[model samples]
Each structure stands twice: as C-alpha cells, then as structure tokens.
Target: MTIATHIPLPQPLASLRRRAPGTVAGVDWALLSDSEARRLREFGLDEGVEVELLHAGRFGSGPVAARIGRMTVTFRRHIARAIHVQPV
Candidate 1:
C-alpha cells in the first residue's frame, strides 16, 4: 500500500513514521539481510506493505524499529544500511 501520512522521519521511515505493523512482523527488513533479499519479492514486504520507523539508536547503533506489516522489527543499524527504499 501507501503511507497514509507524510512524516519528516529519517529516510525510509518518513512515510511510515506513525503507522502500525500488521501481520508479517518477522519479515526482518529490506535494509538488513541480503540472504533474505532475493526472497523478499515473494513475501508481503513487497511494494504494497507499509514500513514504519518505531525507534532508532544513536548514530545507527543498537537496534532500530521498522514497522513491516503487523510487526515492528527491531533491526541493527548495520542491517538497515543494506536496504534501499525509494520514495513512493
């Protein structure tokens, strides 16, 4: 789907700053895993889903929050670096 609102959040989260996760919670994040990347197209993390930034650490340290569908996945900042989301 599309992010219903516009938030001045950081990067990818700008569209998902204040949304809720749905069902595909464990889908990690596109910015995190390469091993899982190729398989992403087959999952719900596809284009129609909304991803939000729940929480982030200092300078990309610790774990960050990405709302993918119904789950808010806490991912490592390094993981997020690998993901690339275009403005929609």
Candidate 2:
C-alpha cells in the first residue's frame, strides 16, 4: 500500500507582499462591487491562474501592480486583498 499526504498552501494576495510568487486560488467576491468583480474577471484574475507581485504603491498607500500571465495588471490595494493566492 502507498500513502499520500495533502497540505494546505493558500493565502490572501494582499498578505503576500515581497514574498514568493503564487497561483490565484480565489477571490472574495463579497468584498468587491459588481463592476470591480467584472473588471477583475475581464483581466483574467481567476482560480488556477499565475500571478506575481511586481510593485507596490509608494509607502504602500496607493495602487499595486502584478504580473498575470503575459499581461501586467494594476489595481487598488483593497482589490489585491480580496484575491486568494497559493504560493508556488
């Protein structure tokens, strides 16, 4: 017989500043408005997608940028907070 183990590796994107890159786990839709959610979906921010933090706002008080696939997307800090990512 063979045994296998599963471990948890999910985290909020907002909490991953300056850390390792990760895959998009999920998004807290409840925390975002309809338009905001729609915009993010349009930008390809979905589960199983790869995302990396590129740059943060000045003193961490403005918008943030991240690399998603071949495109780079920028949004408010709050939006990043709503995104769940699993470190890669």
Candidate 3:
C-alpha cells in the first residue's frame, strides 16, 4: 500500500523577512475577510505580483514593510502571513 502525502506550498510573505524578495504566489482568500481581501486586491497585492521585503517594524515581528509593484505597502504580521510567496 502506498501512503499519499501532500507537498507543502510556498511559505508566507511574512516569513520572507530578512530574506531576498519574492513573487506573490497567491493569497489565502479564505483567511481574509471579504473587505480586507478586496482592499488588498485594490492595492495590487493579488497573485503574480512581485514583492520585496524592505524591512520589519521597530518592534520584533511587527508590521512588515514590502515593495509591491511600484508601491511600498506595510502590512501587519498577520496580514503578511496570509500572502503566499515564492522566494526569488
């Protein structure tokens, strides 16, 4: 008998801190509220977007500073965790 296992997906954007920038693989829409997801999409944070981790907030694991497209956006750690990314 063969056991089936699932391959893990890419890590979340939040985990990219201190690492090189990555491309936005996808977002956990279910993890975000409708309005929140919508807002993020409006900000051009949807799938296939290229994101670079600029820096973290003063406090540890606080807001994440990232560059998405041509704009820079800061996201809470939780929100950053909701974004799946593939490191470049």
How badly does each model clash, as a count of residue pairs? 7, 0, 0
List candidate 2 segments past 4 Å from native: 1-8, 17-19
How does model 3 fare in lDDT? 0.83
Could you give candidate 2's per-residue lDDT for residues 36-88 as a string of tens digits? 99999898789999888887777657877888888888889999889998887
- For all the candidates, what are their Cα RMSDs to the real structure? 7.8, 2.9, 4.5
Candidate 3 versus truth, CA RMSD in Å, comes to: 4.5
User: In candidate 3, what are the lDDT values of residues 1-88, reduced to their tens digit?
Assistant: 9999875457888777564778888899898888889889899887788898887766557898889888888888888889998877
**Predicted model with the maximum TM-score:** 2
Segments of candidate 3 deviating more than 4 angstroms = 1-9, 58-60
lDDT on C-alpha atoms for all candidate structures: 0.50, 0.83, 0.83
**Candidates 1 and 2: which is better by lDDT?**
2
Q: Clash pairs of candidate 1?
A: 1-48, 21-69, 21-70, 22-69, 22-70, 23-70, 31-83
Clashing pairs in 2: none
